[model samples]
Structures are given as structure tokens and as C-alpha cells.
Target: MSKVFRSLLLITALSSVSQWAQAGNYWKATAKDGWLDGYVEATLLLNGNLDATSIDTDVDNGVVTLRGKVETDTDKALVQELVLGVDGVNGIENMLTVFSPGENEDSAIQRKLTDKKVATVVKTRLLVAPDIGSTKIDVNSSQGVVVLEGQVKNDAEKQRAVEIAKKITDVEQVVNKLTVSD
Candidate 1:
């Protein structure tokens, strides 16, 4: 074969190999990386207070992070433990806080969701709500009740937020601290 024909054939072979390798990587990311989502969801769902809807999980190299809203200080503490307890979770950031509008990430909200007896009930109902999700909003629980704090777009969102928090099975009451913007 002439030199030019030989060079062209070599490039074609290499390109095919590269394409195959790229396809394999896509599958790996989908299958291998899927566990992180499941791990985070499982940990929250196990708690009566949290469900899959209110949280989002992302993993990098077996390190998992959970971001979302729960209904109390105790819930926050519980989540930190749950995420950390999972098989591969190395570092967990407790972004979930007790509901406080002015309160920074650390401020505590006094409500039942933080309370040991009823947090599960409060969290479950919130998870069921049409408006809230596993990630958006924040929940605080104290003494078996619930406190909700976060920014929503409108009054409907605010009311929906309150409604969801109140619906949890064990929630004795709901303290809606949600803020709405026009």
C-alpha cells in the first residue's frame, strides 16, 4: 500500500477504539454513579421525617452529600448520622436546618419536627406535598411538631408549604415560618 493509504487506515482504527471507550464511560457513569442517589434517598426515606422528595444526593468518588430540608434540629442531627452511616458515605454536610428566615444555616427553630416523638410524622407529610421536594425549603421540629422556613415564589407556595408540613402522620402541629416573594 502507498504511505498515504497506510496512514489513513491507522487513523480509522484508532478512532473506532476511541468511540468504544467513550460509550463504555457513559454506561459506567449511569450504573456506577447511580448508587449515590439511592444511598442518599434510602437514608432519608428510612426516617419517618424525611422522604425521597425533599432531598438531592450527589456523589463523587464515594463521597456523598445530602442537600434538602428537614423539619427540626433533631431531624438535622438524625440526617447527619444517617448519611454518615451509609456504606460509602465519607463526608456529610447537614445543610438541612430548623426553620428560621433570618437565622443562618445554624439557627435553631423550636418545633415538634425537632422533637423526638413526632418528627417522622411531620417529615412524611411534607414529603407528600405537591409543592415541596426533598431538596427545596427547610423544616424544623421540636417536641413532636414542625416548623417550616424557606423562600417560595408566592402565597400559594407558602400555603402549600404549611399544608404539607401539617399533613405528616405524627405531626401534632405546624409552625409555618415560610416567606413568599411577589
Candidate 2:
């Protein structure tokens, strides 16, 4: 009976220690995430190209979520790029929308904005696609036409890139100038 009581106490102590260790880890992760959030916000504020006033940033376990509107798609992509450069940023969920107030959709300015948005979207999709070397590809858009240029690892990759660009809304045509690499 005495030995059984001692064993029970030992087990309870071990369980308590395990719980404390887990709680400590949680607090450490939370603190790290908070630090990363501040760093990301400061980085955005310091960038001249970004209007950080309209942006909202949140960080969780090293992942950052950006919610807001930007003047152009270039600005949206730029935000993600800048945040990704921050130390400890594991990933990003970019929810930025391109918006220009008081502009008519049919107007030339609006058309240019749409074109830029299409280009940015295509470039981002290519960058995220599996097995695609997006760094080697240059994406451009003008008047609803998208041009893909650069070297691809194989013909299949070239075809995949063209298909991805073509599927994007507002992309009326996809001109593939991708060379198959040796």
C-alpha cells in the first residue's frame, strides 16, 4: 500500500510538469508572434510605396494575414513581398483588393489598373504553383492580353504556365514566349 501511494504521487508530479512545459511553450510562441506582428507593421509603414493606413495586419504562429485595399495590384504584391522579407515570417495570407476610388471602369485609367492587376495575379499564381520555376518567368499584361516570357524546365512546365495565365479573369489572350531549358 505504501509503494502504490508513492507511485501515484510520482505520476501526478510528472503530469503537472508536462502541463507546465506545454503552457510555457504556448506563451513563448504567443510572444514571438506578437514581436513578428510589430516588425511587419513597421516594415510596411516605412515603405514609401505603401499606404499603410488602409492595411490591417495580423500574425499567428509566424503566419501573417493582410486585410485591406491598395491602389493597385502591384501594391498588393509588394505588400506580400515586403512582409515575406521580414524575419520569422513563415507564410502570408494576402487578402488585399485593388481599388481606386471614383474611377470609371471604362476609363483608360481603370483599364490600366485592370491590366496591372491581371499581371500581378498571374505572376503570383505562377510563383505558388508546384514544380514551376516562377523566378525564371516574366509576366506582363496590357489591354487584357498576358505575355509570359522566360525559360521553363520542360515543355510541360511551359504549357502549365500558359494554362495558368489563360485561366485568370480578364486575360483575353496568353502569348507564350517561354523557351524550354536544356
Candidate 3:
């Protein structure tokens, strides 16, 4: 065989091998993604707390994307947590919106009323506490989460404000954004 012919044949063989390896890798990635998609879907469906019928799961490489609407913020977070627990999931794109079908105008008004009541109770407690400077602290509540924003005389006062908010009835969580001015 001519030297030039041999060189051409060798190049062709290397190219074919390279293409085969690339194709194999592509298929492997695709298969893995498919498996992950099914696994994620099954996980969501198995969770009794989640209504996964409206949710869509898409997996590419090792990343999973969850798109759809959840009943509440808690459900949205839960979905992300559940998908992230999957063995091969590198990351999650949670595009879930919170849309509660059962929450009518009355329910929304009730939630707002509860939040307002929580805030009022917390503020009253802070104001009555002699040791803390309550005037400088601002309290806000939403969906049972109380947020304390503003400045305090010291760390002790800040701690006291947080404790007061936490003790309030219907306050699910307290977020302290109080800065110590003293």
C-alpha cells in the first residue's frame, strides 16, 4: 500500500473511533437524564403532601427543572428539597409558583387578619416591656412570619424583641433584622 493511502486510512479510522465515542457519550447522558426525570417524577408523586399532577419535571444532564404551580410556598420549597435529595441531581431549577386554588377571598382576608393580630400582639408586648426600647423597633408580620426591623439599644434588647415576637400566638417564625445602635 502507498504511504499516502495508509495515512488517509489511519486518519479515517481515528475519526470513526472519535465519532463513536462522542455518540456513546451523548447517549449515556441522554439515558441518565431520562432516568433522572422518571425518578424525580416518581418522588414528587409519592409525596402525599404534594399535588404533583400539575407539576412537570425535566432533567438535562444531572440538573432537574421543576415547573408548575404549588398550593403554597411550603410546597414549592418541599418540591425543591425532594428533587435535590435524588442521587444524581446536581442542581434544581425550581420555577414553581404558589397558587392556592382553595384559598378564596375569605381565606386571604383571614390570613391577613391573623398576620395583623400577630404583629399587634408582638408590638404590644414589646411596648410593655420596661427594659427594651420598643419605639425604635418596627414589627411586621406576614403569613405567620414576624419580621422585626429597625434598631435596638443593645444586643440584649434585640434578643428580647426576638423572644417577644417568638412567644406571640400564631407567629410561626421570627426574622430579626434588628441592628444594635448602642
Candidate 4:
């Protein structure tokens, strides 16, 4: 997306929160008002630029959660700094794991596959229709909480992603941080 367009959308999303702040269900209204797009853009840019081995971004209800895998614990601090600058990002939770050298590769693979199973369940339930923008959706799992990030065509798809994420077994929670394109 063009930088100007993205900036404008983010601004609009943030402003919507203010417009609806007086309404009951303040946070829900804030989230529903459309700030997630800019938040995701901010997170993507931050994570993409970070030096970590792997980083995933998930934004839900204006809160951004990060799932990362790094070779060193220091990568966490560096990543936090990067994520803090994004607009409309009300909060962040770190769910990164550090793997030491000589760790059992087989066990790691098994663990990853297990996580992938959770991811697959989310994908199957949420993205069953090929017409949905599944390609844009990114799913990553760590300790069974499914993280969703992507741009959907509308609120229905966004809601669908969340519902499907909720369906994934063993997941403690579903972080549906999908942004809808205008």
C-alpha cells in the first residue's frame, strides 16, 4: 500500500476511536472504529526491520502482540523498541522464545509442528472460503495462542477470522488482529 494512503487510513482509524470514546463499551468501540490497519502497518515495518531471526505481528482490538523466535534474549529488547513507535498500538505482549545452540532439533521440530497444528486448525476454520484474502493472512503459533494478521475486504471477514481462531483447539486465546481495507 502507498505510504500516504496507509498514513491517512491510520489517522482515520485513530480518530474514530476519539469519535466513539463517549460510547459505552469504550474499548470495543475503539477497536471497532478501525484503527487496526495502521497498527498492523506500524508493527509490520518494525518487525520486518528488526534483526530477530523470526518475528510475527498480531493486532487485536488496538493491541499488538508479538510472537518471536530469536537466538538471543537481547533480541527481545531490540524488538520492543521497534514496536513502540506504531500508531494505534495500545499495548504489546512479548511471546518470544530463545533457543540455545545444541538444543534438540527433533524436539524443536515436534514443537513447531504442534504449534502448526493449532495454526492449521485456525486456517481451516477461518479461511475455508478461497475467496477470502487468505494469502494475506499470516498465522503463527507459540504455546497454542493463535496469532492472526492480514488485510480483509470487510468486517465480516475480520469477524470470521476471529471466530475461526477461537475454534482452534488448545488455544488459550485467539488474537485476531486483522485490518479491513476500504
lDDT of 4 at 44: 41
- For model 4, state the Cα shift of residue 30 in Å: 52
Model 3: per-residue lDDT, tens digit, 1-182? 69999999999999999999999999999999999899889877876556889999999889998898977654665677567656789999888888864355477875775666567667756866777975988889999899999988898999989987887667899999999885
What lDDT is reached at residue 30 by model 3?
99
What TM-score does model 1 achieve against the real structure?
A: 0.46
- Winner on TM-score between 1 and 4 is 1
Q: Model 4, which residues run further than 4 Å from truth?
A: 1-110, 130-134
| lDDT against the true structure, each candidate | 0.62, 0.82, 0.80, 0.62
Candidate 3 ranges beyond 4 A from true positions: 101-182
What is the C-alpha lDDT profile of model 4 across 1-182, one tens digit per residue? 59999999999999898787756577675565346645444444534324543667667676667786755443454455445434455777878676642244466664565575566545544544444665678888887678889888888888877776675455787787789877
Ranking by lDDT: 2, 3, 4, 1
Question: Which residue pairs in candidate 2 have backbone atoms (N, alpha carbon, C) closer than 3 angstroms, thus clashing?
Answer: none
Q: Per-residue lDDT of 1-182 in model 2, one digit per residue for the tens?
A: 99999999999999999999999999999999999999899878876546888999999989999999987655776688667757689999998877964343457876776677678667766876786864799999999899999999998899999998887777899999999988
Worst 10 residues of 4 by lDDT: 44-53
Q: Give the deviation of candidate 3 from the true structure as CA RMSD.
A: 12.5
Candidate 1 lDDT over 4-51, as tens digits, reads: 898999999999999999999877876665777685677577765454
Q: How high is each candidate's TM-score? A: 0.46, 0.58, 0.55, 0.37
